[model samples]
Target: MRTLAYSLDVRFKPLFEVMGSLHAYICRKSHKKLDLSPSWAQQVQQRITPELSDLLDGIGIDGDWKLTYLLVHLCPGEDAADFVEWLKGMAAGDLYELMSPYSNLFPAHMGDFRDRTVRLFQQWNEQYMQHVDPEIIERLHVEAMKRKQALPASDPFAFVDETTNGLQFAPMNELKQIILMPQYHFQPINVVSYFGKVTLCHYAARIYLGDEDFLTPHEYRMIRSVAEKSRLKILKYLRQGPRSFIEIVRHMELSKGITHDHISKLRNAGLLTAHFEGETLTAYSLRTGALEQIHSKIMGYIEQGMA
Candidate 1:
């Protein structure tokens, strides 16, 4: 099947990193077993001033995180301070016009949203995002830029899937543009959203630094993904062929949340392939090729140690 062509925009946005980290930090309850756990979020929260905590917590209420993520893209600055100031300078009508196309719900008061969101991001910058390692930021930016250069001659669907570990986000509706952005905080899961005519994909950036202790190794994660009894069963079932997420859930007889978690681990490790049917995950399959590479992967690691 052929994919419709869309204008591809790939770049690293500093605002995305700030928004991504905050979304992960604030929504830690639903993200247990993730690379950064709820415990890590709690530890970080303890260091935050009470006032800032109160302000940021509002973002987690009723999908306000969407507003934060959408709002930040309006700021093109590389620094958080500048991004905050850009938001502060936005006129109410201008802000409304900018956001209207994407959502119908506004904060109870637009005036309050204009003031509060800016202040929250400003303090968020001072208290946390500033401490983010500069090296990781640079690496994500470089990788996004490199992908942008290569995208012109590549199959758009295949490129999106490869960049996001089997997220085949096909073009649909009136969507005419796709932004492929690299993200760090939300590891192991790709975040996809829409606004007006643009589709934004914050693909997980597997940024590993320092030692090779398997902190975020592909081979180790791939091996660890199937270590659990439930995961093995799930894979065995998937070996039959592609099945929608619900079929696996019914067959496993586990809670929906538990089933999704197990599937996520397999997807993250590249042991499974997932495809979207118009923005909804409609199919998942065991990647036999990935299974085949497991042997070579371990051998490659062994070869690395030998060298």
Candidate 2:
């Protein structure tokens, strides 16, 4: 068996959240395909600042998904000037090599795209840096570090393992250094590519904006995962006992594709677990106490607001 050693670097940076939230906003405005809730769309739109809007206009929203990843990978600590300088220093070849995997999604003009993206980052830093709270960032970083250190011994992968079901990768003994970034925009978890020896994993932070307003990224995912009627029904069935995929489809009276999608959403949210009994038979069971834990958090959040 091949073992992959990993370490964590937890950071509370505004650039990551700003870029991510901006990309999410663009995705909503463009009606681009995203697996996010309509409620979140409304919240994000309300949170959008005038400066952010202008920045978006200057940068444009095309290929935002690609740009978001690039920004996270190239983030230069917390300094805005250094970040822009880093972007400016990159050679076209380096940019191309970094972004080539997403060539099909980006425009054919690589040089133009690189220049536009660098300008966008510069504009964002200049326009939005005032809104970033150093105190909040420090608090978030402390909380995130605590969360990372508190992961159960049985699961070394932590939130990554929980969200990805299990980490599946091509067998290699490469030293993987995982940087855990706390993001306010990207809910649950988002993974950037395997860049040399480093992998960037962006996880949602539990940001308490006010007594009444809190951002729980994982909770949002869980709520969204069970929102659909079909998905809710599937969860209900799974709560009874473990069921095979075929059995679930038959019981739900839904098409194979549809049932699979619902099951996948639940599984991805860590609400369900899959066990392969054999080469052919796979059974899925409700992740015990998962929903209850989420419920407690939600209720506590609500009660605190009431107080």
Candidate 3:
């Protein structure tokens, strides 16, 4: 058993190294920029590294995936077939679809690692930019900046300063959210989507709102701590109209155990409202008025930040 565990760890060594470095990078950044706390570490791990780890797991079989990544470190090339075949021989065939070009457009189970890896290589090579084509990078940077400008000044979903700043990283959160979606789109370049327009729009809202660095330091931390990628869907549903506990559970298709805990937290925070429909319990109308006003204000903050 010990040997097996050791071998498995060895097989995943490359993955561990990359993720460990990236995790440290984010932690350092968060610490310097965002008052990194224990909670912040948890958030970064949950929102960032683990997502990448899952992707690595999906694409890897035994050591092949890890080997391919390591080879990239050693050889740095476009083609990954030899490494892919080597990994394939060791593990199940499930990850082939994820590795195939056809599925590259859709969201890979990897989440931000695609970007993170790109960033990592750039760090490794110390260049003007990394990963993406220069033209594409310029285009995306422009588009991201432009999108940052166009976000509404006052959205209908914001609650307080915490919620406002919470919206900052929500796009990354949405990427994580989409990763879990049964119909998630994986376009390697494009960040938009097709299936489930409502769900997509909910994601779109976060993109539109973009970054929010205007909040005070403490406020930003509070927001970041509360609003997570996993909660984005729940926030979306709340936006349309609040639902009863039962309704949210039904709509989200989450387990009762999970939904109950999340709902309790949201309600405690005043982001959601819960009540009774006859003998049964209910909630209604996503946050509006104050929440809406706050949401919009943060959106405006995002625009200004982009500018």
Pick the TM-score winner: 1
Write one digit per residue (lDDT tens) for candidate 2, span 163-256. Answer: 3442323222453566666665444434344444555556545454534435355566677776788887877888898788999999999999
On lDDT, the leading prediction is 1
Cα lDDT of model 1 by residue, 192-247, tens digit: 77675777788888777677672246667888887899999999999898898889
Error of 3 at 294 (Å): 4.0
Clashing pairs in 1: none
Local accuracy of candidate 3 as per-residue lDDT tens digits, 186-289: 11001112121111111111111224556643333334424765466787877776466677788888898888766544443335443322113335444444
State residue 106's C-alpha deviation in candidate 1, in Å.
Answer: 2.7
Backbone clashes per model, in order? 0, 0, 22
Each model's TM-score, in the order given? 0.88, 0.61, 0.25
Ranking by TM-score: 1, 2, 3
Can you tell me which runs of candidate 1 are displaced by over 4 Å?
1-5, 37-39, 213-216, 277-279, 302-307
- The per-residue C-alpha lDDT of model 1 at residue 61 equals 36
For candidate 3, the 10 contiguous residues with the lowest summed lDDT are 1-10
What count of clashes does model 1 give? Answer: 0
Off by over 4 Å in 2: 1-12, 29-64, 94-107, 132-136, 151-154, 158-177, 188-198, 212-229, 236-251, 255-285, 294-307
CA lDDT for candidate 1: 0.78
